[model samples]
Target chain A: MTTAVRVAWLAAALSLTLLLCALSISIGSRSIAVLDVWGFLLRPEETAEAAVVTQLRVPRTLIAVVVGAALAVAGSLMQSLTRNPLADPGILGINAGASLAVVIAVAVTGIASIMFYMWFAFLGAAAAAVGVYLLGSGRRRTATPARLALAGVAITAALTALVQTIILTNQEAFNEFRFWTAGSLEGRGLEITGAAAPFVAAGLLLALLLAPALNALALGEQTGAALGVRVRRTRALTFLAVTLLCGAGTAAVGPIAFVGLGVPFLARAAVGPDQRWSVPLCLLLGPAMLLAADVAGRVVIAPQEVQAGIITALVGAPLFITIVRRRRIEAL
Target chain B: MTAAEMPTHQARLAARRLSVGYDSRKVLDGIAVEIPNNTFSVIVGPNACGKSTLVKALARVLRIQSGEVLLDGSPLSQYTPKEVARRLGMLPQAPHVPDGILVEDLVARGRYPHQGLFRQWSQEDADAVDTALRRARVEQLRDRLLTELSGGQRQRVWIAMALAQMTPLLLLDEPTTFLDISHQVEVLNLCRRLQREGTTVVAVLHDLNLAFRYADHVIVMRSGGIVAQGPPREVISAELIEKVFDLSCRIIEDPETGTPLVIPQNPDTAAKGS
Candidate 1:
């Protein structure tokens, strides 16, 4: 595509993302007017609508935006690092691993706090990342994308079953985990968003800085090294960033699936595989998608709501299948 | 045998008693070598004779266990990878091209070492990419998808990427592997042109005839040791070829390039002249 069209597309994506964020704040169950939302955003006041805006919608929007960026960035990083276009935190069992850890944390301590369970999320994500890599590897060589995706599916299935068994047996933990597993933004305040934002931010920063190295890595490891990219270091940093993003994202929202999987695919489809463009594109597209899911969830049933996770799955699974049918193996 | 010394020119990239290998296996054992500046050097050897290992070590792709690589009079370890990359480049044995990537897009990634996080896509980078495309004659193929290109075209695209790095030194490993003989000559010609343009080019080639026909300097290896190193005509003899390759052969001068050409002996006969 021409530069002008690409730039225009980029601008539209940003505007659309901002519009979604605004819509997320404005169109909750009660439906505040856009004028009122704008007014409240401009000037703080002691009003009930302001309270609804500040106390509820704003935090939900922030968490959606943060988690959206984190998951999408993590997914892009995984795809580039593994040379696997099909890679996603959810598909690769990272989210399942985090879910199991959070469940175990709650079952063990009866403490359902974000601060308390997020650490376990990181550990579980690390373990799953390593486990999938080992299992996915092809006969003494590095993992091919097909094998890695299969390994991811296997690991995801196993961990998800373990999560189910734990949640079913432990009633106390089930109460804490059910709302989370559905992946809703309801009843969560700024506290959880605050707890998760820094990690997401760090992961985003690392990803952005490592973008050029990732581009070099696209040309195999030895070539990347010859080009002065520290391959092992870049891979390690990417692993750390992916773990942080997935861990924090899973902890913030209970394993929200498909935002990571689909947004970056859309980003690459729009632009090319250049990480510098796609990664930033993911930041915009990711939130636009999740907030769309979240907003649609609010309006889908009006009073009673479906979870954002359910909506994304409804949308993302078809997209995933289309991608599978469209592309051959490990070409990226 | 020791390499012939040319005390006049200082070698920019040289190794010192380099000993490297996997555990319990020594691939290159205490081999010292110097690569002259602004010349086409080919490392030719039998299978597993450590030619690729030596080139990889000089390119700083593999870790050295017991020796040091010096680039431009400084130990390579002292310079950051990016710093070294500005002066050296390598086109690996089988480099992967990302599917659906345009040739220009793939070539542009060669600017990674020259680029920084905030300082991406400068005028210098664009100029380098253009120059590389022109130099490798792939400028016409700039918009084409890399995967859609022929094997020879893809090889030139990879060489274009290395050229885009704008390094003074370039190393290629079996760059003509999958290409036909004509394409092999095409790649070797490109390397020759690169050498003419004042870039030191080192290629690890399996084809001794092509290696000798094109290389201004040749490093011959046998069983992890440098058997000979000098101009190809002096270094590549029938005796040396037979000793290194265990193949009886006759060394004939190439009529086109006036370089040594190896013709294997007929095993059934013991004739001195054909």
Candidate 2:
């Protein structure tokens, strides 16, 4: 593809993402028009429409965009680091780690504040990633994709079991945990978004800076090393970046499923495997996917709403199966 | 040449009492050798004889367990990775190629060491990539995806990438693996041309005859020790082949190049012919 064409596609993707953001703010439970949302934005007062827009929809929309982009970029980095197309925070036990940490924090201390959950989630995500890395690299040879995936499966299973044990034992904790586990963008406010924004922003910055090295890494470890890339350092930094991304996003909105797994495939398909291009595209495509799912969830049951996590699973599972069934899935 | 004058063609890469192993199982033990500047040096050995291990050590992919590897009279560890890469380039056996990457983009990546955080994609990088593609005869395939190329074409593209690094010294581990006879010869010829153009080349080769034909200096090994090192005529003999490979063979001269060629003597055929 020509440079002109690629730039044009990127522009189109950006425009679509902006459109989704607008839709997310406008078409919630109240069904406000775009023009009305614009008018409300211009004049902030005690009007119910303005309150709904500023207090409710705007924070949710901002969180959606931030978390969506974070998960997608993290997914791309994970896939490249492990050279496994199936590697994602949700699939690789990272979300389970954060979820388990949150459950434990609430069950043990009975603190239901978002700040506590965010800190615990960050620590748990980092620990889980390190656990997975150690387990994968424990093999006699360098870690293969299958080995890393197996490690992820094992960690996910163990963490989920622990989470279930905690939630099943305490009824009150279960009530709070169930809502968070379902992964909805509703009822969240600016406080949650503000708490997670710095982490997501740092992760996004680190990922973009690491793009060139990630491209070399796609050529395999020894090859990347030969090309003057510091393989071990890059891998370490990638883990830190992924931790910040998955932890903060999960903490703010609670483990929304499939955005991390599905967005990278779409990004790679749209713009080839070069991380320089694919990573940025993932930033846009991820939010678009999440917001679209969130909007669909709101409208699917007019009086009530399906969670965004459920909707993403509904859409993402089939896409995942299709990718696997293809004759050749790109390895990195 | 006089003995004093010979020092002018000094070895740029030399290992002294080098030891390498993985997880306490030593693969190479106390080995010493020198790769002279501007020569096509080939290291040949039987399977599992530490040929790949030695090359890996030389390329800094494997850390030395003991002793030191010196590049241009300085210890390899003294230089930063980018500094070392600016002087030495390596092409590993069966390096991964990311899917859907254009050939030109792959070659341009060899400029990584030359590029800094702020210094990116300059005119010099473009010229180096262009020169590498033309030299490797893959310019026409520059815009094509790497997955679409044939095996030989892919190998040449990889070579083009290495060439774009523009290092004075190059190391290859079995560059001709998995290719047909004609393609193997083509790659070897390219290595020969690179040597002629003053890049010091070192490679690990399986084919003894091809090594003899192309190598200006040859190192034969058995069980992690150098068995012989010199020009092919001085180093390759029937006795050395039998000792190193455990295969009885008769050494003959190539009709076209007069390089040493090995004709293995099968026990059954040898008895019947006699």
Candidate 3:
């Protein structure tokens, strides 16, 4: 019966996602009809409007969904793995790593392709994850949530400071970063999507597999072990998955903030903390949230789209603060 | 039913000359114990006496430093982690509950060992989870967030999770810690009920009185080694308490159950009496 309920919820969530996606396709700045969006997606060869919709809005909307899901799922994974409700990709320095690496790449080699940025970001994220894991674990038999969060804050602050310094030293690099850091969804082509899709997919898969183990982990290492979970391997895999998801998403979108942090928290409020449900709900709610914000950005000011990232922050910061204030945000 | 009729050689759990510790310090050394089938045994000791450590080692949470734990007489290390989990379940002291986790879902996690990579959810798993929730008496709180439950209620939820594992042997580490007197009795009685239903139960208890009242067998530990082991009346004495706990205590029978109860005499009172 519980499985049935969860399946029903998943089905409902998926349907809602599709509905939101359709609404997103229809409600952009140009206000294309739902029928037109469907026609454009299904049979693009028939009309010019179809071609325009297929070429521009489809990829953009899909990118919003992918980025949203990836970031939120990564955030949720990191939060649970570290047992900290406050944990997110950006707060943990994964995004900082990606952004800094990209800045360095752009500064040194004048490389600006999303592909190059993706690899650079992944490398940086890997380094940061390893660093945090080692520092957080300390001499303890297992890493505690409080230790991991502290380690994340320290490493993230240091990396952010370093990245800021690079931006400060180079005017050209700052000019590029200044625009990208605003977190726009403008002009991100199919190539950016292609570059990020595989990593995001892999992250999604890894997170799904790690969900049950993470559920046990939420009960602490000893209890998790008593339940037969390989806690160390589970934790390592979770960290790796979060790195890939956040790294790839940030590389694609140049650091969309708070979507990762906010969406999963909301998903938890909706579905509860069993990661089997929480993770999948995160995948759905994430993209719905991102696409909703993107659409809001498009229509909130005609012909002048607000960056989806900025919009998410506008919505997310207050909500996150509310959670912190109303509920205890301690590690599970 | 005769002993032979019971799960024969199902010597489901045994520790063989086991030594367990952290870093260079030993916590349990060269101790051999067999958890007899269908018995409720309790490990009782003061704080830091290695009762919990011994249970963790027995459950494979802590690595054995020098010896082996066995299941059905086979080396425990030979069985896969999941295999051991399939037959043995443990409830560690004060598990860190996930925020806003529903009690039902938390209990459902016990089914992880029985689940396969391909089999997501099954009727069998559902039945086991439901049965556990009922047995632990948390069925009414199934939809409630674990955070919303009281301490005893939450503790029961954790036990319910262990029950969901459907294992024959259940180990609990300080399962009654932090509970009020009433709640402590409630939890101990719940363990007794489980044991009566044929689950082999082992618990590390801090309250000697409670252990004496609840356990069929009691193992006392001090400084990483057994101080005494037997039925409570046969083992607990003023001398043993002084030796293990460094306290002068008077041993008396409880007014209700007639179990041995330790009354630590004040040092002043002892001096005055002397």
Candidate 4:
């Protein structure tokens, strides 16, 4: 794609995202009209729906935006860092890291506050990332994608085994683990968004800052180094940004499995290879996609909503397959 | 113009007692050579003779074992990577261009060394990139994806990227490695044209005839050290080609260009006296 076309596509995606975010707030279970939702937002005294708008739907929509953007940007960064189109938060084991941490917190300590679990989730993700980095680096400064991937898989397997073992030993924890691991936005409070917001914001900031260096890195280490990018520093910084974004998103939305992978992949297809524009497009397009999925999930059963994670997986899987069939993988 | 009045064309790039290798296998040992500024220099030797290694060491991609590479008599290692990159640009044998990368964006990356943290796109960068694209004859291809171009066109794009660096010295390792004869001449002509624009270019060439025709200064290497280096008239002799390349060649002049032409004797008939 030409640079001008990419810029235009990104702008269009951004505007569409703004519309979707508003639609998400108004299209909840009670089905408030768009005008009434806007009126409630503008003037609290207008309707009885104001409280539900403020208390439930708005916070839910905000969580969707933040989490979706975080996951998508994180996925884009990971794919570039690993130079693997298949790399994503779920596939590369970051979501598994958060899941293990949340499982231990809920199963072992019976920590009920979602706010507190955010901390453990971030820590667990960081530990998993460091494990992967160290194991992959293993005497080499830069690890190959294949090696990093293997290490992530190995760590994920071990942590997943531990989670299953914990669940087997204590069936009491199974009830809590079942809902969270299945991935939903149900029963999540506003405080959860507040808890995970700072980390995701910080991660987004790091991502934008690292985008230029990451663009240089796409040309491979020798070319990137010759172009004066500090290749090792760039790689390390990209890893940190991916970890923080994916970790915090997982904390917010309970390991929304393929959103991180799928959104960025779609954004790249839309915007082409330059990360400077692609990252921002990923941020906007991610939530637009997730909210659309969320709405689809809400309407799929008429009343009984499928989990947003399940909906994303359902939609994302076919879209991914279509991408694999239609576009050459090398184009990524 | 007097040397003093000239636009600082002399870039004294040299390596002092440079030794470089991987682990215990020393590829180059105690190698020393001074590169003259504002001239087309070619490093030529047989395979594994450390010509490419020397270029890498000079480019600072490979770490020196004992000595230091110096730019303007200051140790090259002492300069920051960006600082070194500001004055010296390098093109490895084959640079990978990601699919769908636009020619303009790839060229814009050359401004990385000069760009500040907060600066995204500046006028200086745009001008440099524009000039580079024009110089490399890739202005039309600037909007085209690299994957869509032919090999010769893509090579020009890579050269445009290095040219966008606006560095005084450019180092290329085997820039013509995978080109046909016509494309090879096209690339060599591009390098010579770059030298005409006041950029000092050093390239590694496997083709001795092309090297002799294009290079103002030629350095022949044998077993990791300089066998001969000077103007091609002095360096591209039959004896040097045989000793350096282990090939029996007769040195003749290109009638039209007055450059040294190497005519290699057929292998079957070579060394009939022996």
- Highest lDDT, which number? 1
lDDT, candidate 3, B121-195, per-residue tens: 899998999999999999999988888999999999999999999999999988888999999999998999999
Per-chain TM-score of candidate 2, chain B: 0.95
- DockQ computed for model 3 against the true two-chain complex using alpha carbons: 0.59
Off by over 4 Å in 2: A139-141, B1-9, B269-274
Q: Name the candidate, 1 or 2, with the larger DockQ value.
A: 2
Q: In Å, what is the interface RMSD of model 3?
A: 1.8
Q: Write the residue-wise lDDT of candidate 2 on A31-105 in tens digits.
A: 777888988878887889899998888988988999899999999999888888889998788999999999999
Score every model by TM-score.
0.93, 0.97, 0.93, 0.92
lDDT of 1 by residue, A130-194 (tens): 88878988565466777988999999999999989998898765787888888887767789999
- Candidate 1 CAPRI category: medium
Q: Residue B177 of model 1: what lDDT? A: 84
Question: What's model 4's lDDT at A111?
Answer: 73
Candidate 4 clashes between residue pairs 3 or more apart in a chain or in different chains: none
Which clashing pairs does model 1 show? none
Write candidate 2's Cα lDDT for B14-108 as tens digits: 88778999888888898888887899999999999999889888878778899888888888889777777788888888788776778998998
Fnat measured on candidate 3: 0.72
Lowest lDDT sum, 10 consecutive residues, model 2 chain A, at A1-10
**Cα shift from native, residue B133, model 4 (Å):** 1.1
lDDT of 3 by residue, A4-52 (tens): 7777777887887888787777776666677867777776666667766
State, as a TM-score between 0 and 1, how close model 4 is to the true structure.
Answer: 0.92
lDDT against the true structure, per candidate, is 0.88, 0.87, 0.84, 0.82
lDDT of 4 by residue, A1-332 (tens): 56678889888998988888887777877777789888888888535589878777778788888888999999999888877777787877778888888888887688766777788888888888888878877785667777877887888888889878877887875686767777777666788888878888898988988888778778777777777888878887887888788787888778786777787777776776778888999989888877777777778786788888998888778877886798687724
